[model samples]
Target: MKIDDNFYMKLAIDEAWKFQLLTYPNPAVGCVVVKAGKLLAIEAHKEAGLSHAEVNALKTAFLTQEPNSLLKVLEKSSEIHDFLIKNHNGFFEDCEIYTTLEPCNHHGKTPSCAKLLSILKPKRLIIGLIDTNKIASGGIKTLESENIDVTTKVLEKECENLLLPFKSWQNKTSIFFKMAQTLNGSIDGQISSQRAKLYVHTLRDKIDLLMIGGNSVRVDKPILDTRYVKGREPDVFIYSKNKAFSQAIPLFKVPNRKVIISDDLFKLLDYKFVMVEGVYTLLDILKDKLDFVVLIISPKIRNGVNSVNELNIDFEILHENYLGDEKIVFLKRRA
Candidate 1:
């Protein structure tokens, strides 16, 4: 099968989606390195203050070309970048690089990716979306100046969609609703696969706060932490008019986590990234304020009460993929 630029770019986009929202305060990004139409490395930015997608891809590519090189064991972004710059040995000189976002031109936590690419002298650089950030926007120009063949806007819309959460949080609070339902649309019981549930746990690990209806807390009596992923626990905000609840609720008992109970929704605005896990009641109330919705739909159909009949809403599907037998969808409310 002959692979085109779109094929590689799409792969990069999908790889980035795996780490979506997990890279809070940092745009989730993916990169692919291809030399002579042979596969090399596909990597994504996994977290804030970590090696970027480009660096990770290039490092992996270098190792593929020079297996015995001393690139291993270097975990920090700066360390990997420095090692690659010193020992690249023209490994990427004939390669084509695909990235979902433009390389950063300005140095922040990590060194300038554009500067490194210029030195590595990759034959061509394909970008899905230009960096909208003022500080990082000059990468294309930098690459062009270095005479590295550059292509832009490969799968532009899909790449742009990937950045929605990052952009929303940069300007204001980004509140996305998350819920799981069966094929029949029933919201009751556990509807997500273990993989789907793990995804939710990873999101919870990255978010600044997790909001849910007070009724959910009281009834489920759940331990709403990232225990499955062994990740950081997010603070919880319980939205309810009646703040009177038994102290025995599992969520309220989690150590080192603040469980805020209030009727005010404005408190959600205080956090940059917030995930709301609830059904019709909370969704209806938060419809106007939500930036997106994450639906985990199980493959099974059964007789049970569903949220579909409790509220009427239309959302445009932004992205969808499978987690085992479940179909996870990202949607935006239609205007």
Candidate 2:
């Protein structure tokens, strides 16, 4: 009973921050499965081309030790590595997965979670971040050529701050604005915290494209949803040049929503996880089409004036945490 491994790799980096920024262009990653130390399953990668938190925590530890398997082939499925190589039964011999990244060794749309963890032969394999992409890099050298026992920078800086927007969308589509404020830097009066607006409605339910700031859709007629999370809603983008809107703006009567009023932030490169909220003149007009910024603050001290403390902007925070009274942080931009 000795294994700790940073308490299950910090619970697989806190279950990959509940799909941080909502797995755009995929890269949220998470997984857990354990053995003597017990856990069994944890899971993450809940979207974008599907299964990959080590095959949904190795298909929930092979249907939790095959409890009569066939749970609808792991429900909302993608033919997971041929039903986990036809239902992994070797009860993962002394199991111990952890993952946050680095298990994909190619063969798209499912299959090759490092070649199905070298055919379910787990004994050890920690990882946090490594797939430097060549279509999911070597997958920890094919699980050390099936000798299994792998491990790479566990919890590596919270899995590289949850793959900073899938490594800023690996060459293109990035954005990320976010904002919140207060403690004497008023980003509006609501100063946040229904758990920081339910973590911005769970990053607007793993975003697809959000945008907003053209006087925040004509003075906050906002309903840019994900209604505190349950998923599906992001396809808004009101960038603005006002084509006369106001059918009483509940994000324009959300019904199979797709809003897009545009003044074109180059139509946000077609899309892949954009966020962008508002103020500071929409972050100095998209501030070179940002890539990250979150901020937040909120503790209380409302001396308002649309604060980011009268911006000058440079960014570089990288990470900081908190949720209740708020303080978050996250920035980026310094090179």
Candidate 3:
């Protein structure tokens, strides 16, 4: 079956969607290689610290090739750069490489992927979305300068969705925090309501970690699993000065979960990768030199209880509504 340019580009988008599974706080990207009129390889960025989409796709394409074969073919071998160059062989010689987003040109944490592509001598490059970061934005220009044919603006909307997080991160210099709440605006009520439990499960699937105070764990007894969402589970982060949670807590059963006990309780728990979650706990973490993002899930209030205030963050009541007997109020942090 002959694959048209549109078909290959769509395949690239599908492959890139896999990055959403593992690229928390990072933009998801997918790549596809069509060599000698055949779909040679396809893959997405598996996780934050793993090899990128380009590297994974190339590795899959060059599986039976020689050691450093990519370096020999492309004349470069700096991890990410070499992966693109080596994989460009006969496949890309007179063909196109479709990527969900523009190739990266910056050298942050690695060399420029664009520079490597130029050396590999691919006949044409098709981009779904452009890079928003200034440092990495001109990949097309870099390729064009080397006389490589480059086409873009295909599947622009899909590309935009994949690159949205990266653009947001580049602009804010922080991870984009997303939270979903009930129509009444509560995550969970005073008691562990079913609706709230389902919301917690949703949050667990979206974030890299599930963070809460020791009090919440003791009160809610959450399992912190993503079984309800059918996606990867986030690591559990408990904000506690000591081991206030019982050994029977469901978080303990999860392999990646960590109990962030302070100096007062560090000796109490023998778990690895511990960090403080609250202001008091953060002080202890700074003292121990540990770092992590704190994710707080504030559910709706049933009566007059304020979850934001408990965290010491000042928020203004935006609106209020009722769901059955439960009272839901929209609160925005006071700037």
Candidate 4:
């Protein structure tokens, strides 16, 4: 069976979304290795300062074909690239690689992925979006210089949508508001699935700071730490006029976490990547400043207080998908 480039590239896009926001200062990317139309590996860039998606996928493909090889246990990108270049023995010459983003040409914390692919001489390179970063943008040219068959912009729009957060945060302080609600629009209680909660925790792990209404802090007494994902605790900014609250709030007790209580919203500008969690009242206050809005709508609907407040702001849907019975949407204000 011949491989569908769009199908595999869409799969790669979906894979990359899993690690979105988790790869701070780096773009989330995914890759697939196919040998004679059979998939050898599907991998993604999991974190910053680690291997790119192409390198991880290539390493996984190598180990899948040669399980006992020392490459199986290697984690570093440079080491993996070296092992593959030294031991590949033309294993990937018959394989095609699909990646959501063009492989990087410049070396930073990791080795150059384009250089590795050039040396390996894969049958073809199918990429979604060309890297826009000046330092990393020459991968396509590098691959072509080696006479490798290259296809660009497969599912380009979806790939570009995946990359918006990375590009936005790089240029300015990117802020997004997130809320979990039921089908009836009730934002109260635990409505999201456990998996959805985990997704929020993972996002909390990556952000520099988290902003929430003072009302939420007092009522829910939320721990607000990344306990579910065991990620670094982000600073919390409570948007409240009354600084006097019970000292027993769980967030205040998180070790090494900076908890700030203030009425000023501009304090958000001090951080690069920030998350705001609230309903209509908070959204109304932040409507003009937010870059994105993440809404999680759970399946079950019941009579309760609705999440929406008296707010009028139009949004353009950027991406929408399911997270285990919950519908997650990423929206941006319509320009």
Candidate 5:
């Protein structure tokens, strides 16, 4: 069946949600397959190095057909494309493939997904999104050459959501940072207990990763978990140059949290998934080669040292909220 723009939009939004699955250390990817007016399969890239969205969805569909069948699916499945070799029907005779991003065309760690799609020759290719990278881009162009029906732009906003990270990574940029502060521009005062815990929890839930310096961790000893939020939890990344924290620390007790130690401190800790958080130990990450977005929750009241100034980088105010005498200022690094 021919897929409509509305269908594409739904696919796009679903794809965006998939990208969110990879928090902190992973990239999100989501996919869905529909055939004969029934949702055949749905899957998302749950972890790094696992099969991608397309592969996972296809596998699920095949498994549902034969619960105990385990025929080398991806490799053998390539033959299904023969059905589309001619307009008459080789594969995808009446099937529809819907994905959040463009099908991959390159043969990287795995075979080219684009090539596999070409073989399946689905009745129609509905792309909710397009790949933005120079190398992996242009799956639509490749498929069009073979005369298979294709449609796009159904859920552009949703598709764009899934592509946000790749676009940011390819552009060598980060998301605009935001923060809340008091009327006087203070996140805290003489005592660290100034800002409301509810506001801090809100900030933690929206971010894919939460970052802080050794000083922040030492001073606040934050729990850094997102139990209060409705969504998945983000990974907590602590930047430290020395062995100031230990496994006995409360943060380390969390199941999936990671602490990035500097080379100077690597010998002191033996932990998996641990790496350097920023380019310099004491320097702010905004000043380094790593361009991931950061959101700082601070007070506008400058009664204490300014965290932005202490990092030694220029930042712009993105948002502001006032609570009585306190002012919350959201700031972002200049591109």
Candidate 6:
């Protein structure tokens, strides 16, 4: 495929999305540095307190220029900033960086990405969305003042979707309601593929909280941890009014995992990110509070039960992507 700015930005988004769960309390941002139509480096934020996407990309790209010599203290964000500023006099003068979110301008935990970019002097900075957080929003101005070209709102909607978790953490806790159903709308049995099931578990590793309905727990007696991905499991939030849950349930026996039983969804606001997996009644109860929905489309048509058929409200499909043999549709309320 012939490469263009759009293609590069799309690649950045793909890279960023992979780590959305991994970077808890931090936005999963991706960056790609292109020089003379050649890809210099591509990177995404893997976790908090580590090098951000832009800094990581710059570090990797810089290494290609100086492979024989080691740059000391470059892994830390502040050190990376100072190193790049001192070394990248004209190395990135004509290069362009495509990023999924605005470069940060604040100095906390690390040096400001905007300040580093200003010093490195990239030819252009293509941004998806301006940072809404007050602490990191003025990066565009800083870059512009340094005479670097800047572009905003490239793939804005998709970038907004990518930033949803981060924004939620800043304002209110983000809740994504997930449901797996057959093509004909049956979810009674396991219609979703094993891969899809594992994918859900992988997400479980990164989230702060998991909210499951009482009925599903009673009937399924499931363990909703992130064992499949070998990552840290999230705290469990049970949405049952009654405290008479089963002691035999594996979820209750998990060591060191905090399990809170309550019907009030208000408690979730205190969390950064929360995942809810339930059928219609659960969805209806959280209809007004939900920020996103994952409708797992299974190929099989079982007749046991279905969550989509039970949905009573209209939804807006934010984005749709396939996973394994299933189609993952991300949606929000039309209301």
The candidate maximizing TM-score is 1
In terms of lDDT, model 3 sits at 0.57
Write out the backbone clash pairs for model 3: 16-30, 70-86, 186-300, 187-299, 187-300
Once fitted onto the true fold, the runs of candidate 3 whose alpha carbons sit more than 4 angstroms away are 1-3, 64-91, 173-219, 223-335
Every model: Cα RMSD to truth = 1.7, 16.1, 11.0, 2.1, 9.8, 2.9
* 71-142: candidate 5 lDDT, tens digit per residue: 334333344223223222342456677776778777655455677677667777777667767777778887
lDDT by residue (tens digit), candidate 1, 206-233: 8989999888888898899998899888
lDDT of 3 at 233: 64
User: Considering summed lDDT, which 10 consecutive residues are worst modelled in model 3?
Assistant: 287-296
lDDT of 6 by residue, 1-335 (tens): 95767788888888887676568778889999998667988899988899899999988887777875456445787777777787786999879899999999998778889998998888899998888888888999999999999999988888888887677666778888888888887778667778888889877876788999988899999888777787777889999999798789999887668998898878887787898988788888888888778888988867775544455688777656678778888776786
Candidates in order have lDDT scores of 0.89, 0.77, 0.57, 0.89, 0.53, 0.83
Which parts of model 5 have CA positions greater than 4 angstroms off?
1-12, 15-27, 71-91, 171-210, 213-215, 221-335
Q: Please give the ranking of all candidate structures by lDDT, highest first, separated by commas.
A: 1, 4, 6, 2, 3, 5
Model 1: colliding residue pairs: none
Deviation in angstroms for 99 in model 1?
A: 0.8
Q: Candidate 6 clashing pairs?
A: 187-305
TM-score on alpha carbons, each prediction: 0.94, 0.34, 0.53, 0.92, 0.53, 0.87
Worst 10 residues of 4 by lDDT: 302-311
Q: How many residue pairs clash in each candidate?
A: 0, 1, 5, 0, 32, 1
Q: Per-residue lDDT of 1-335 in model 4, one digit per residue for the tens?
A: 54489989987888888777779889989999998888988889999988889988898888887899888789888899899899999998999999999999988899899999999999999999988899888999999999999999999999988898898798789899999888888877677888998999989988999999999899999999999989899999999999987889889999989988999977888899999988888999989888788899898877777855677788878778788878888887887
Q: Give the 10-residue window scoring lowest on summed lDDT in candidate 5.
A: 271-280
